[model samples]
Target: MKGPALRGDLVTPSDARYERARVAYWAQFDEVRPSAVAYCETPADVAACLAFCQDAGIPAVPRSGGHSLGGYSTTDGLVVDVSRMSRVGVRRAGDGITAVVGAGARQVDSLAALWKEGVVVPGGMCPTVSAGGFVSGGGFGWLTRRYGMASDHVLAAQVVLADGRVVRCSESVEPDLFWALRGAGGGNFGVITEYEMRPRRVPTIVSFHLRWPWDAAQAVIAAWQRWIIDGPDDLGSAMSVTAVGGDPATVDVAGGWLGDPAALERHLDELVGDAGRRPEIRTVQEDSYLDTMMAAFGLTDTTAGQRQWTGQNPDAVIPRQHFAVDRSVLVDRPIPLTGIGEVLAAFEREPRPGQVRLLSFFALGGQVNRVPRTASAYVHRDAQFYLAFWVGLDRDLPDEGDRHAAQTWADDGFAVIDRYSGGEAYQNFIDPALGGWREAYYGENYSRLAEVKRTYDPHGFFRFAQSIG
Candidate 1:
């Protein structure tokens, strides 16, 4: 196998005209570029790159899609571009189905492989998100209410640590790293090459969408708080402040039920029945499990090597949501409207100076909640559901006003969030702005994680803004 330098072209900052390499997912900032992009094609290539960075005393980051909202994967140091390693393989073991997929694998690629077998795995809702980052960060989605987060179904991992050694971690061997790698995230301890995942059988379900006038924003938010408390585990629901018309003022509360159409209809009928004006659209359709997953991603089918994106994937909400934002708390209870106002204030200040959209995934007693906090590296056990403040920026909006609004909205939103969750933040979505992010990302387990970090990377070869010290 070829080394890191040969598998793909390397771009260094010393070169004068490499403009494209300097951008990230948000691409709003100028200094947000990597020192060198090490394009790797195989497991051996990844191992060699880590070794090179180790001996040379150069810090390294791992990039799959460059889709990270926090831009953690693309550090100013060396980056291992694993996007070229997207090879997917599957095997059926008796009644069970096991797939061995590469780290660069995207959601659509892996879901299609599983779909061919008439099976499903809990993955990201976005077609473009890479499996490595998605799983490493506690992945949640429509199927999450049924089988739990994507990390929960991880059976094993093929990991490459900082010191250039390859070891397989599972329930049976290297169990500590096994726990960390499943949910803690990649580049935290090592580079994950393959994931042995537990696949779930797809179900026939009903999907419902209720698009309401902008005036009904408060109504939908309150209704969801009540419905989710007693909703069925099979019914996975989320609400978004999406732009349905010319001006971005419409709200869409859409949910997926893993059961029959009649059952889902009854549930929606009971939940939103009190509201006088019901949504009249018939966007709901019943299909096979794979089709539903594709629909969840907003894509239909795929051609040869080209990626098919639905462009309607649901993303997590951040309180202060601007084109470029920071991470906040993950609370157990939905804040009162009076408090939500502060959140909206920050959202309005997005770099594009637009209103913030709040997205919530209600926790309706699922396998994820049943798993104890200490069971894995992801310790979000008491959480009733996941809350993400998702904001979209008008690329053409004036820079000064947008930044002002975005900052005010973020500062106000964080104030209220502090009242509820002890200033705890989600590590996965954090920006470089927070103080003691090691605690927010890892919680009380930060010290232990640092020990793990020291054990694996004694030379401090893989440091970053939020990495465990």
Candidate 2:
């Protein structure tokens, strides 16, 4: 069947820019070529694209930051690229501030804009991630412990539904749709045009990083789990074990505290002291909330187009281009010491040259758990921490065998941790290989989300491999 005419900028496979337009952040998905890429400029343009896809019986997917780890953003039919729709503005509301962010706005640009107003919306660390997917998929960041997930701050949204109808949803209007939008709204129910988010006042923060030798992995992991589980809400941290190619593994802990430098230092001292191993490298600095965010993004170097602060070099922006696969699980209880050793052993079993392996534990709880599981579409509120196993091969490597090996290692690593994960997963880090995803991602909320899906997207128009319906 012939597809209907699309009004927005359409790039076919024959177009000169098709190759670039069709590419996603993860190179593993580059092989999934689409019929065409449509850059939607406005809500009307989005409607037009969806209408065309429906008329011609073609699948349509929305691409904002192109950061879907599961490659759900790319489709074989039509890709609605909203990256060009990025725009941000602020307004005063009673005693607080609210920012109207375009769905396509990147995290860095959004942060820079909001910083000028001395406010911020908790978001992911990656700069190029779009507000659309990040917020809808339960976004988290430095302020997460204090303010909760990014989805919690959303006040309203402008969504273009499956029937090509634009509607406004919020607590007072289209409340059911608004509830679904809070967490699992990723490309399933509609195309979001804009988000009205409540921003919190930027507070002074102390950012720190500490590193210990790989041999202390067990001790550090044990100590970290005990400390962070009961840590104050003012603190948020992540512990990771990483190995690049055949290099020795290293354990690193990094985080930020929304308080005085001296207090943070004391806390860090206790953390290290508990682990019974002094870190070879420890660095802590007090900076404005904006600078701390910049540092967290690995943007402390001078670079073109980056605004320079008084004390630091221009921040360097790294493009998201790599061949990687990640799988994650939510930990409700502390993992046993033997289980932790088993996880480390899996990484040691397959040490592929030129492949990077990372196992990360992101601290959850605090205000994130204060919200009830049934309050919104995000159901992992009771999880203590999120565990992810990531494997990345050099994109330049042409050997398919090496890529397959890296993927296998990642899969095996996840299996080891899955045994202790309480069978819960974060919806944001969607995994394609995961079985029983409906229960894993949404839990009891799946039924309601499916009902919402049926109401708004009865035809199953907006869908991917693991879509809600």
Candidate 3:
């Protein structure tokens, strides 16, 4: 039987665009060639694509920025690529500004557009990550500690359901679905076309990057945790130890501060005192909100219009990952120095010849935890910080054996930190290998999410690996 007609363009296998269209952010899924890719341009386009997939008996997956760590953005079936729907607008809502953002809007574009209006949203640092997947998976970043997750600021959304009905959901309308969409994770419910978000207003920000010798990794990790755990909510920080190829590991701390430069310096001084070592490299600047965000991703030198994947725009500079193995844990309690040592030791082990290993800690709490776990579907309100371990292969030297070894290293490293994890993981990271993901991602809210899943997609049309059952 033939499928329903769609207004959007469809790229079939024979089309010249097929090869590029089928690729996701991570090259790991580069071989996942779908029957056709539907480049959705409107809600009607999304509805038509979903109906066609149903009529044709083919699985459909939504592709936004194509940044799914587990490669869930593309599939072997039909792909609803919404990258063409990128649009962002801001309007006054009482005393605040509401950002009307398209689901396919890239984080960099959205940030740049909103910054022009003197407002910002909590979003990831990845320049090319889309609003669709980011907000759906409970987005977090430099602004997260002060404001909250990106989903927390969502005022409303337009979703194209499985039945071809375009519904706008919010706190008052389709409240149950609204609850689930916040943190239930994307691609499980319906395809989001647009979002209405209340963005935070900020006039200035202090951005800083500090680094210490690899020998100070343990002190940095230990003191960083204590500093963030007891620090004010206005502060946001990410501390990481990274080793690329044969280079020695480097311990780095970087983030944005809402306060002035003097206060930020005092905070850094405290951190340095606690760690008992001054940073070997330090760069602090009082910059605009937009500059701080761009600096986070090393895109301060590029224009927002130029910070996309080269596949999307030839002039864009952001490059896609070849392959990666990522694992995460939500730490409610601080890991002792011994456990921290174990984490560092695990990270230093099995250093491959052509791999980049990274261990990151993103501070949680503040406004993120101020909300009750039951307030929304995002239930990890008690976490003090987020701990993640990942290994990426050199794009030039892709190897299946190296990939396997990287996964093994990630698993073992994750195991070390998992001992201190509060039995939860960041849904945004979305690990395919995570055991008990239903509980790890949603915690006490899984049952309610499953119920929402039944209500909206009882037939399991919108399903993927680790989707709500």
lDDT per model vs. reference:
0.66, 0.86, 0.88
lDDT over C-alpha atoms for residue 307 of model 3: 81
| Best-matching candidate per TM-score | 3
* Candidate 3 regions with alpha-carbon error over 4 angstroms: 1-4, 93-96, 303-305
- How many pairs of residues collide in each model? 12, 1, 0
Off by over 4 Å in 2: 1-8, 301-317
lDDT of 2 by residue, 1-469 (tens): 2343555688889898788788877777888999999888899889988998887888899999888988998999999988778888898769767899999998888887888888888887787789999999898877788889999999999999988899999999999999999989888899998999998886678888999989999999999998899889989899999999889999999988998889889998888998999998899988888778877876755343653222122353465456887888999889989999998898788688878889999988889999999798988898888998888876554478987887788899899999999788988888889999999988999999999999999988888889988
Q: Judging by TM-score, tell me the better candidate of 1 and 2.
A: 2
Write model 3 residue lDDT over 337-439, tens digit each, in one string.
Answer: 9999899999999778889999989988999999999888899999999998988888655777887899999999999999999999998899999999988
User: How does residue 140 of candidate 2 score in lDDT?
Assistant: 82
Most accurate candidate by lDDT: 3
lDDT pick, better of 1 and 2: 2
Q: What is the lDDT of residue 186 in candidate 3?
A: 94
lDDT of 3 at 439: 89
